[model samples]
Target: MFAGWVQERAGETPVRPRDGRLFVAGEGRQYVLLTYTLKKSAFSLGAQNAVLPLLAQASNAARASVPSAEVIQAGVVLHAAAAGQQASREVHTIGVGSMIGIILLTWLTFRTFKPIGLIVLAIAIGFLGALSVCWLLFGRIHLLTLVFGASLIGVAQDYGIYFLCNRLRADPQMDSAQLLRRLLPGLGFTLLAAVIGYMGLALTPFPGLRHMAVFSAPGLVFAWLTVVCWFPALIGAQTLKAGPIARGYKSLVARWPRLTNQPLTLVLVAVLGGVTVLGCSRLTVNDDIRSLQSSPPQLVRDQIKLSKLLDAPSPVQYYLVRGATSEEVLQREEALKRRLDPLIAQKHIAGYQALSNWVPSARTQAERLALIDARLLAKDGPLSMLAGEIGEDAGWAAVTAAHLRANAAPLELEAFMRTSASEPWRHLWLGKTEGVYASIVALRGMRYPSIPVLGQAAEGLSGVQWVDKVGGISSVLGRYRAYMGWVVLGAYVVVFPVLFPRYRGRTWRVLAPTAAASALTLALLGFTGHSLQLFHVLALMLLLGVGVDYGIFMQEEHERGSDAPWLAVGLSAASTILSFGLLGSSGTPALQAFGLTMLTGTALVWLGAPCFIVTKEEPNASPVLA
Candidate 1:
């Protein structure tokens, strides 16, 4: 009776009997439900009614029909229940492990109680500042923003180390205020410049880069404040002395004068550059978003089960489509599906789900409803008898009115709608605020490309955009590569010339060390089979800034013939490298990139510093110099 009522209300035809089978109008396949007379199974009628609408919607939205619905029988419910439990267990495990790893790493890195407390406080302030700015600008912090902000540990530690190092090296007779006055200007200006460089990322078109820029920019200022203000006071009160400085650094710097002037050093720089260029050329950008999946165990297992059960492809691949109207959208999607059919058959694509298959058009729905009416309401039909003694014309009118009323409830017809109004579905739509509609057909389990391939099959369709396999980590990495190139070119154009405006001759000497350090870092990265990512590029830029500091320190130290400048350079480079080089051991790829760059760059800059030192005797030399 309920089925008959639903058929009447939905304007669906009653099932037709053919070869001892009943099939409803517009149904793609037929099914039978058999009930044995000897057995009476207990089930709640109210519960069944509660679930019927959801079942109906799923059936209507199903891309293919069940060949034999009775094949499930009763055990299907048990199997589904078991799968849900298994998925839940897996998710719990992965989430727990990930949390533990984050906490352990954080505790291990910030072991020094006093410095760690100050660093944590600074990070908190910086995070709040970043959160406020991101909230005001974008209205909410994206998931990527949190990840990028957490990764700022390597960059933020620089401030603390610089402050602590200066405090250790200060004359015991000098007060805390005097020590701060000496270090603050250099640390403050350098950090300000670094913040500017990071903030410049906001100019990029990519959302991830913009989020990173917003998060890191404010963090820099807060970190600087903690180091210059809070950190110095803490160190002064404690009367901290320099613990054993790395004696290896002094040995390393002792050879710098000879290494800088060597013919082999220039040759090594050129060779390193050549190697870097070749290796970098071979490196490809990976845009696969799946690379970021640190998915909880249960989600991964559930995904695997879903893929097996439905023979569905991975949702990693995406097809970008744009059109002016619903018809154009459907037509384009239909056209793309036809092109994709061969790929599907070849297992290039497992399966595609799209709105074009379900609705087709509003005109199509209206025509299907008309056909359903004729098929169900023939003379002496079960539905006709159920309509309660009405004349044929009156019965038809009553049925049509019911159908029209059902259709009027937009939410009821949601399954029939071309696009869903749900959040997950909204992600697939790329509509503008002005009502221009667009959709992406995501694909899964595509073959990984080792080399570039091009063609019509490769190029899905003309007039429609095809993102294909480019929207994940590879895309982010590619943007970073482009940004790095721009930074390198821009820094040379802007920074190098500004440093030595009066003397072009001196500029080459400064650039030589920076270039050597950059090349050596790139070569080290390449030799290790590590691709230079965005963080590496930023680190390279930072290496240039540090290289300038070293050059200035060495030049000044050599002129004064004092041990203090040498001590400062050694201690400063030591603190910078120790803080950053430790990051090379990080589990995260981004942090590793930062560490490797800093480690190689700092090592080379220290080696290259003495080349900038003036070795010739002064004309009017004091007896101290003589």
Candidate 2:
């Protein structure tokens, strides 16, 4: 009875191209589909905002009427909204946690609330500069930029920390100007290195990485300016006595084994070098696009259920048919459907949908009409035989045949498209685009592995193109991952000229820790079976800047014969680890890869930096530290 009622109403204006099959269908039971159109694109925030209200109204109406009927929620808009909400929640949670962790680390490092305010002020200035510039340049900030920005807390604070550490070791008689002049070269060099690494990110065409680069690079510049221009005036002469932790760093650095110690250094290098090489050999790569962005599991399950129930064609993969006219486009689509029929017979494909399925071309419509007239409407045909069986007059058969012939008008594509029947499948008809008519033949039961075989169906066919969004994205990711790896290596070569002029023969001393740490980090990832990704390469670029900061600090302190640089380096590494370690626990795979790389790489840099410290007796110390 319910099916009968649905058929009566649905059949009144059935889904065109195929009639009521798309609206009402079932084997032994019944299923009804109600498609509600939204004003904005489903992925847009406006559409997502409207989804809940629509869902609520739909559920209420369904329950009030049938009570037992299931109101299944499915479609692109619904899943997109759920993914957006989940990502928002994660960003909030991770952002808050990273903030709290950084704040506590800052307080612990200085053991004063005053420096916390100063550091936070500097970080805030940097953030403002980055956000403002990003808005001006890109006109908007991506959520990914914000997600990547959380780690900037650790990086942006380095310049301020270096300035403040210098203050702790400065003479009480020294003014702010004297301190700024002394610290300028090291800070300047550090800024140059960091900018080189971040600018490399901007070179990529990927919008997410480009946004993050724009967000981070300018923020660092503004933060450095805050320290250089303002930090001295605020607290230049406010020197604090070296705390226990500072003294502990001093002791650790003093007792730490130097690479100048001969046999022991060689043994350590040989063992570690062997391990690094082994790990490098085991390195692999993965660039699957699905790992980059994931939807919520419940939404995924709901989508799968809806797809199974409807036997619907995939929206991501399809064939685009193009022609000079609407009729030509329809005729081309009909040809594509014919190519797909054998696959359907072999059970390799389930089914497909196209505009031609409902609105056949004028040529096809005329042929069908001619066949009907010839077979059933002839003078001595089935109509006359039926009339004879019913004992009707001979004139009755002739009258009925005349009525059928008069009513057999061809269904025009334009007339059908304008009707309510075409509302659900309107997306399949691209009546005019770029001076050509195009239409999509959406496919069902397609797999990525079968794409090459399936794509052959369109081969040698004019204006027919196979479109696979997911496959295309995955291929892009793989290409960029390899590109980024080369770019990271190029960053080192690019920074070499800058360091060579300043440090001269000692340049390798400054770059060694970062280079070694990056290699080992990759090796460690390999040993643990973690495939290399674009995120990992991105993190390595960041590590190049940060790890070099450590080496520069150590070398400068050795030159000045000051115990303060190790303390500064320790504090910097701790803060960095605190920020990125939180990211190691992130739900997002890309961020997790980035965080893990930084967490491991930074620790190794801290441990390896002391080996490069040259003492008075080791003036001619070998690069091997022997």
Candidate 3:
């Protein structure tokens, strides 16, 4: 029936044999169950293990012969390829749009070739540097690493904006060195805060999170270096006339005193804080890895169709049995198989296959031999009865161990595993690692809670692991979410105390914008009832980076009594929003969560910046700020 279905789908002579070959490839590294594609799915490595070679084979076949049944495309792989192309185009479009927006905005603001050219140059170099570092660290960057980490370009923009904004707002008579002197303190402090926020991600166990941190942190440094070491020389002291953008900034700041210094503003802040608290209390997190991937409807439909037609295993979960030897591993696996028997009978699981069932443990083999001898070869047993019935009692009495053995070959592990006949079981027999042998018991048509129940049934058995690819990755995400929560808290603890000596009385002012942004983010999350995912926490880190940067810049602008720098802050915020705003709209759940959080949080950061405005700069206020 499956073979007919494949032939029907392909409209050809049985495009390929419809057989269960899930574990027959890669010598047991791949899973047979799947529900998503290779690009965004949590089980990407396993999916690629199955699909990538098939694609390569198809390509080679295309070159070698006319198109035939062998050149069939798996639905998931084709969907993944389409998704990849869409993602690349989306990223490219966003990149080009951001660059164009920045160039035009900068051109309009600075009205010079040098600053625009330098900004573009700095951004390009910073991006290249980030890619190079990621290549060195991860060898090959994962799709999510680029999808999430690419936002580093936005972080890098902050430095360029600040430097150029400094140039814009500086004393025209002041030389470039004096301008650098004034800009250095703010830039340095911003970098410090950015690093503290990004490095929080570095502390998490998730590689994608760490890659994002590494990318943004180093990318920021390189971009800053370009502006500091190269910008001023390339673009000499140039004064800019007031344009509509500059006038718009000035007009907005003009109302800052009236709008923010009122008692109503305080009341509003208090109310917002109260609501934010309520929202945070109600927030829930969804750590399921599938929540991050959100498979396309078409791909999902295809998967269901294939599954129904082929009765294919769609096990989102599996089990790993490990022991000191193959025999021991098989024994433990056999124990689980025994446990699974009831579940299969109950229909809690469709079925399961294990290496133990195919190749019983030596002890089991011995037991089977003993049982056969006791039942048939002993006196007055089946063999003697059969011999008497056949009038061959003497022949039966002469039977010995050698004759019963019947030239049976010893079940050696190496030879059995290496043979082509054992291909179906190869994936089940995971090879030894670090002196412990491993194997997987694949369960078909299973989900969570069911696996947990099965796991409970199999409890007390040593080295039996219920590994739900989705659940396992989700648990990792949950753990690291809790972990990064602590890291973020630690940053606040470390940053505040360290900065206490400097901003003694106005310390809260420095933290105000980010606090408001965070509060607003939580409040929005609560109101929207959006289940926070791992990517949401990741997005929070990026928000904090932007929040801190905005907080630092607002302080610098108000304390210096120059609203011109506010233009830079505003533009930088806009760029960050533009980039991540698009990311928030991604089809992939992870990128969407990341982008949505960033867009929402950064908008609030922009709105909250006014609360930190230095309405009345104290005459004795220090210039040491970020």
Candidate 4:
């Protein structure tokens, strides 16, 4: 009775039993079950919403030729209950712990009883500005954008310390206004360059990169303004005077001259360079999107469960199929599926979701309708009863004839349209072209080899073109690493040659130390079995920039016989090393990468300065002997 009702309402004939199962069929092909579900509770709404439309449309179009797809809404409530319990425990242990650590760091850095109050204010203002700018330009800030922007805590503190440090250095004879004038230009220039570097990332096509660029650029400016304009005004410069020397730091400075002139420093840096080179070669790029997520949330867990039950795997890789019409598109999709079948069988791929499995082309749909019509005609004994009173009436016959005439012109389905030529789905059989029309097939759990799978897949496809968009993150990071490496190298090459044109011959002296330091750091990482990733490469490049800056500063200071040069280098290195060194101790992988790179890079930069390389003009240039 249910089958009869479904066929009558759907304007199609039921070809099989009314059992609640997903079905797929084609002309001259038998119907097969794809998946099944059980009706249970309200939580099954996600599944119902996704599957109901396809089932209804298929049943209505196929008439009585295919069974209606069943709706299974069970199991979600139980899954949600379990997930909630797990989340509560994790929040208390991990989430609260991270919060406390962040708070403690903020307090120690600011060194004020009211540091928490000030930090809250700074965060509030910075977030407001970020949200306003993001909304105005991009409509929404992605979750990742907010997470990365929080890193401003580290970057912003640099500006704050610079301000406080300069304020403390100024002679007590000068007032606050004089102190401000002395520091503003240098601070402003540094902040401007930092802003420009971040803004450069916006040029990339990646959404995440764009978000980082937008949030960081403005946030840095705000931080600088806060430190220079607001922070000093609120906390007087007198409050920043160095306290009584700690025993550990005092002893280190007392031994500073001996440590600075040590011959073993060069040898140690050389050894580290060899190790870094080896580590660099072993580094792997992970493009997995899930790696960015902190952990799987409850929704993801439920989705995973549904995916397993429905035999519909979440796609780890996408296969894009394109054509001019629905039929052409489906044909291409089927062809790609055939090529992937072997990989699936070999367990190289878990499974795939393709449109060909759900929606057939216009030609195929028409052919199936023709077969159903022929079958109904062959059963003439029941046809009259099936047609009922409508078949005997002239008005009804005319209406049916007009309906058939309209459908004969080829039905236009929105699902078959493609947007662009470059996109997998470009061509459409109906309507004006707007966006590329393509179907994404999710690859099941497969251990994809490191080699290019898309190239091999493309080779098999021959005339049909296919592209993989999954590796976009790796590509972007790789390009950025390359660009930043060149930038750092160019900065050293150009700046040194221009500043010391006659001493350009000795450029390698300066570069050798920095290079050796970077190499040794990477070598240590590799020796420790830590594989360098994209972030590690980028961090190392930044370390090169910092190293070069220190090398230049130290070389210039040595030429002037400033007794305070060592002190400046020591303090500067201490500030950088302490901040970045702490970063290496972070639990987060990306933070640790940055920390390790900076820690090694700063130490090398300190040791690699051309102090010992005594130029021809100053052959007796020895701060130690003086």
Candidate 5:
């Protein structure tokens, strides 16, 4: 019933076109523009109703049933349904395989059902906790935040395996408490450094990154706690046997000495590092926000098709106007339009739309009526002379009064809002926001320069705000990338001071492996021709913790007791790589970058771990792996 009402209101009118051209009533434009009601799921102004889609479908079904029907109800959905549904199905199918692969990898590596269940439980707890926290903060979870939460899976996987691997390598006399003591410092430091990075993320203005930081920092801590608190009590110290996989891993890394131990190799590695840095310097940094999302090709094509059919490109920028009263807002919009009119004539912009165009201010309306009287209704005016020539039936005053009664009446916003005509342009009205009447002037095909012009024009006007959602998001990314650079610099300054008391002169050793590992990984990215993005930096957050974990854990393992130095660290590193490598292998650009960063960084850290190993012959171990 409501659909019928809407149809009748938007249907063709009796007023004929001038020169075969008519203004689209609601838009106040010479050309007809198609309208799409895009519903945003967050921070909404009204209730959601699914009835529109159902009505459209029912109308289409009726038209199909009745061949006599002259028109059919259809939408862009008809052209898009198959591709969209197929894309969703493919995504789910890929996700299922990835989840199964994670289970199988953990199962095969641990060679037990208990470790699998334990690790999965920890991940589940961590993921659920992150989601719950996000829900509390935003009142709803964002899809991007969920992506960040999923990134934690690699770190979560490491937390479980790190402690569980220690169980496999613990001494015969070792108690659960002894194992906890040995692992505590390393876990604590790695977790702290990671949390610090996330803390920087939380400091940013971007809500997505802030939520990611909140989700990850606490989620990782809880996962680590699960390992530290429960893994001991659950798995007792019983000199557990190593699987065949462990033996092979040990034998493989044992060759680290021959590969990296020589002075010649060290000098060559330094040269390679220099070359890598040079190459990385040559790589470009693109902070374009569009690259962050990898929309499928079919979806992209469908969007283009829809936009073309609409006969208007989407508006990328908005000039928001405000006032204490509706009249003030309308007057302000008229002034803005005057400025915009010149730009349109010069072809700098396509056009703009606002409520003011349809409902001119009362002052402007009076001016219009006076201009009509002077030019056409006066005794000597063109219309009066034409009336005399054509033998008119009425006097000038009668014709003038009729004209005043018909077209000279001003359309106030309140009265206009009650009419059927208002429904089409109602969204342009932001309503009484904070006691200020507000409306948005949407600009189409606008360039960056137009943004500054619009903002400058509204400078003296109170409550006027210029908003460009796409540009603003892109700018935020550009700024945050710069912010994280400062954060990384800050981390280095803070890290050295904190570690100074513990390692003193040897503090340099603690920093070397990660420093080298990070540089080489970034260099590898340059080598692969993959541009670094915010995701790469976020992935580096995970890598930072992993590198520190390897260095600290290896140092702790050496100081304490271990049947095999490389075995426990290797297992932990392998699980991280295994987890992220699989995730990166998927078709997502962001996930692939993340997985690649973790895979490369962790592998390098593992290879470099033996650099800190002190053999009996030398306290400063000869150049080995790492």
Candidate 6:
């Protein structure tokens, strides 16, 4: 077919058979590429989950059919399926463990399951409301959003824990509503601060982060509302006692560093400053998307082998050609083909495939037909001369008739598309999109291909574009990382003013611990050789909200002479650490980054919150804080 098409150029037969074959190394070796077209609905999670097993079965069957042949499966669907499964597994395992730990901790501290019930109820309502809102707004929630949302188990329950802690310390005669009224200032500020922090996530252009922000902010709001509105009624005044565990926690709180002495404050600041400076100095950033979600090692190996064996270009990189009409699109693709030819010869790339390779332009078809007429079909051409020489008039007449028919009919892309031969390459012909005819020119087996060289190939050509998915996403990640850093700083700046009127001189105390914790977390990540990514910055955004809650709880409880604010703060910190710390073990690099940041940042906030407490010299001040 290839030889025949070479002789008869500008036909569909030559190009359709060998689509996306960027390179063919040896004459003896034969390769057949298989392409699958999925239904539009197959992209949804449920559909993808259903399709994955079938794909696996097909892969196994193909491998079994020919032991020597490699059947490597790849596509966006497969990648999404694997990532979804991984995320589900991560969320399930970590979520269950965190829940169990939180339950046991609550039970141990209070010696009752009532607080556990209330905490669980709050989280459930929060998560359900968030999911409902997400479904209403976006139609479908993303797996990443849920993964981050799982951390809300730690965060959303904080309001309840603080209420329960204050309840434990409340006067026996004090009603639930009275206790709630007393705690409202701290809890309300924490909620507002948290919302502000998450709003920063929503501000970013990154879809994943925005989804997470949307999921989280609503979850927090609902959780806080449940505690504020429902908890007083559900959690009516009950006899409560501080268990041994709670007493021990209180003892630890009693000894918390006040940082009130001038020398002590200076020394602590110097140490933190030195660590921050040194650690930040070592900080580096890596925004490559490959670092986020990694395929299984075996799958990675198979994909690499498949790409090398097939000399296939990066699936995510291609040229999109556009024109007013199909003919123009084909012409533009042909022009791109001309530019790529020299690069192929120079070994810059292995090869490329375009729609024009299979379906020639109308002009090209006419030219080829003209050549056929001159060479064979004309009266004095080869067919007539051969018939005159050999005197086989009937056969010569039949051959002449066939050539005339070939010249009379030109194969259009539309007609060729209806044939079975066009199935594999049909996707390349994007008939019309956004009022313009378009098609793709796929490249493969590029050797150290730079943006400059590849981009320049389409520079002089109109309606041609170089689209690099990986590069574009990585660039977006980097840009947003910078934006998120400022957003974090902005959250603090913005929240400080809101907090100032209420706390007045103590506003800095409420905000300072989180700022220090964020800096320290970044420094620690840098010192530990972890390159900062967008997700790390995102974690810091969450830290700003959660860490401030701890400071507010400590400051408010200190002012009110509560028995032990640290009990609630410590429990909140522990549960948060339990939830997010487990994320450090995640297979997804982004989740792992987030988990580590939260783990370190939350712990620092817990410790630092006590240091910033403004102590009073009067006897009315809580003796525990002395």
Top TM-score hit = 2
**What does the lDDT come to for candidate 5?**
0.66
Which residue segments of model 2 deviate by more than 4 Å? 1-34, 41-50, 53-71, 90-92, 366-409, 447-449, 623-626
Off by over 4 Å in 1: 1-189, 205-219, 222-243, 246-255, 259-301, 313-415, 418-480, 501-512, 545-547, 615-626
lDDT of 6 by residue, 179-294 (tens): 88888988999999889888788998867778988899999999999999988887765745676768787568667677654676778788989989999999999998878767
lDDT of 1 at 141: 61
The lDDT of each candidate is 0.55, 0.81, 0.70, 0.52, 0.66, 0.82
Worst ten-residue run, lDDT, model 6?
Answer: 8-17
- In model 4, the worst 10-residue window by lDDT is 421-430
- Top-lDDT structure, candidate number: 6
lDDT of the structure predicted as candidate 3: 0.70
Deviation from native of the Cα of residue 418 in model 3, angstroms: 5.4
| Candidate 2 residue lDDT tens string, 246-354 | 6566668668877765677678888999999999999998887777666677777877777766766788889999999988988888888888989878776767877
Per-residue alpha-carbon lDDT of model 5 for 1-626, expressed as tens digits? 34874454333232233654533332232333323454543122121234345646765876799755432223334333433343344344433444565567556556667877788778878778777777887786545456446556666766667676777767768887788787787677777766776676687677767887888887887888888888788877753455666557656755555334568877877897797788688666777776755655655665654443333324556788889898899988898888778887766666776787678888898897788767666666676666667777458546765665586566689998889878757878988899888998876555566666756656665656677677688787777777776666677677777666754545556666777877888888787787877667766665666676666666656554353546666666766676667666645566677678878888988887666554444445433342
Could you tell me how far off, in angstroms, the CA of residue 182 lies in candidate 2 after the best superposition?
1.6
lDDT of 4 by residue, 373-445 (tens): 5654333323444456544644444455456546655434453333232222221122223444455555546
Candidates by lDDT, descending order: 6, 2, 3, 5, 1, 4
Candidate 5 stretches greater than 4 Å from native: 1-114, 124-151, 237-239, 257-263, 323-325, 345-348, 390-409, 431-436, 444-466, 559-563, 585-589, 620-626
Q: Supply candidate 1's per-residue lDDT for 186.
A: 52
Error of 3 at 308 (Å): 4.6
